[model samples]
Target: MDYGEPTKLVFSLQDPKPVLCMNGDVKVTVEPNGRRKHWDYEVTGSFVQRACAVRSRAGHVVAQIGVKGMLAGKDFYHVVVQPGYDQAFVVGVIAILDNIHGESTRC
Candidate 1:
């Protein structure tokens, strides 16, 4: 696929990472390389999500995913992902992050 082309990819989490493919063939994972946490993240099979800050090699960010009434009717979240970066993957990671925060706040 060429740059600027739109290709939707769904995602889910079992642990660490897992993305539902566009063709619905299998669950994919987009984790950083071993011992590299803040490096490149693979969003499409083996494609890098970010070519630089605030943008991806696949595409640019179309919209953000945030929630209102998070605390005291406040809006929160600063999710940043490009259009063709597989929203499902972004959402899945967000879910995990939220879950971790929620669990941590429990006790």
Candidate 2:
């Protein structure tokens, strides 16, 4: 993304189970993997940049994430994932959440 960092696409993890996701001032977090394992998308701390760690059950980082802020009312998430992360799986999870919570995209 020209507005942020270069985007990298990862293959699907194929497990789009529900997870708790939060973004506070561009600090994103996702956790609670499918098998009740403690998996978390740990976003790095930065005053300007937004980065995340896609962690595994063993608390090891499996991927990295970044994002570009979207303009108001875009109805889209501008996520940038590094290698070892599954882009499809991430997007699919969001899709599932949106399906269940129809107001997620409402501005």
Candidate 3:
């Protein structure tokens, strides 16, 4: 695959699941530098209980354990990815939301 091509990756959850725990569409723009690449995106939503791992086509993780949350009715999250680490980063955001809201469990 050419590293100069623009790519868009998306992950979504369907019905039977509450939208409160779902994350909105995440758009990643891949741009090429001199000998590396860069990625950037904006997230909009609340109560995101997901963990994502973004990797490249060569299996290099560009992002890991990306968590999304809300603060003062604003969307806030942290993406632990290092830019220009590799070429063609494939992101896989996993949802780990469960019925912990009504349960009393601590770890």
Candidate 4:
């Protein structure tokens, strides 16, 4: 993902040891596959809470994910995507996070 900067994340199924966690704060750039030229989105929040605010490069918060099931379970979460943002894209980002954190998709 390129937001016109040096920051990016690269992943591959072939990689023996994939990175499961971001180094520090909960910040990342996401670009959908086959859409390298498409606008990349930024996700930023507290690493501890895992509540993320998805924003466009313009700094508008298009979506936000809340830790709803903090007391119930680690697998539960809630996301609110703004009207203009694609719901599928938001959900896809959430799904990627689930995979990275081993949330609901864990075996």
Candidate 5:
């Protein structure tokens, strides 16, 4: 599926009180690389989110965070991130709707 233009979002990191917001719609291009699919995202967000005072080997911030928006019908998806030099943690958020079976479904 083609998402057309990328969506924008924001992320707030506690501790020095840093806020990151994308200037425009991020461009996400997904392609198949070998066995796993690779997602290439190009975004120009504000200051990266960092936790604590740890720094990288190159003397950079230890962590960073960002957010992205997704569409699940009328509901929306928000992605939280904890970016590091080698790895990152991502969290996805979606609206909860009451279904007939009392369960949530994704559009």
Candidate 6:
């Protein structure tokens, strides 16, 4: 099986570092590499209810994900991606968030 290209998850250390939250809330900048030369996207929200939103540099909410329901003790999340945004990328970021917070994607 072929895994896709490398995806990087960068956390800011200063200037615009992410805020700390006991509830597992996170804020991160995505795709800041110099080659593409574009503004980075930001993902922010809480992991408790799987509520998260991705915002563009222009301060628009391009995508958001939240718990839609629970069944058999498992949560179901609903994701909404605005036009011109990458849906897969948004979901990938959420997956990374889940992994980081020891949620659904934990080992």
The 10 consecutive residues of candidate 3 with the worst lDDT sum are 96-105
TM-score of each: 0.33, 0.35, 0.31, 0.57, 0.17, 0.65
How displaced is residue 84 in candidate 6, in Å?
1.2
Q: Where does candidate 6 stray beyond 4 Å?
A: 1-20, 23-39, 105-107
Question: Over the stretch 4-79, how does candidate 1's per-residue lDDT look in tens digits?
Answer: 5255433232322334442221122344234533322322221122111222334344334443335654335545
Worst 10 residues of 6 by lDDT: 9-18
Model 5 steric clash pairs: none
Per lDDT, what order, best first? 6, 4, 2, 3, 1, 5
Model 5, span 5-84: residue lDDT tens: 46532322122212353233132233323353332332233222211122332444433343243355332323333364
With a 3 Å backbone cut-off (N, CA, C), the pairs that clash in candidate 1 are 19-28
What do the candidate models score in CA lDDT, each in turn? Answer: 0.37, 0.42, 0.40, 0.58, 0.30, 0.63
How many clashing residue pairs appear in each of the predictions shown? 1, 0, 1, 0, 0, 0
Best by lDDT: 6
- Give per-residue CA lDDT, model 4, range 14-107, as digits (tens): 1112356443333344533544553445667742366778777688998888866654555456778999778876776667666665666432
Model 4 bad stretches (over 4 Å): 1-39, 70-74, 105-107
True lDDT of residue 26, candidate 5: 30
Q: Write the per-residue lDDT of candidate 3 for residues 1-107, one digit (tens) a residue.
A: 87453553232322223455455434334443335343353223332344545545444656554436755653344557677753223222222122222322122
| Pairs that clash in candidate 6 | none
Q: TM-score of predicted model 5?
A: 0.17
CA shift of 68, model 1, Å:
3.9
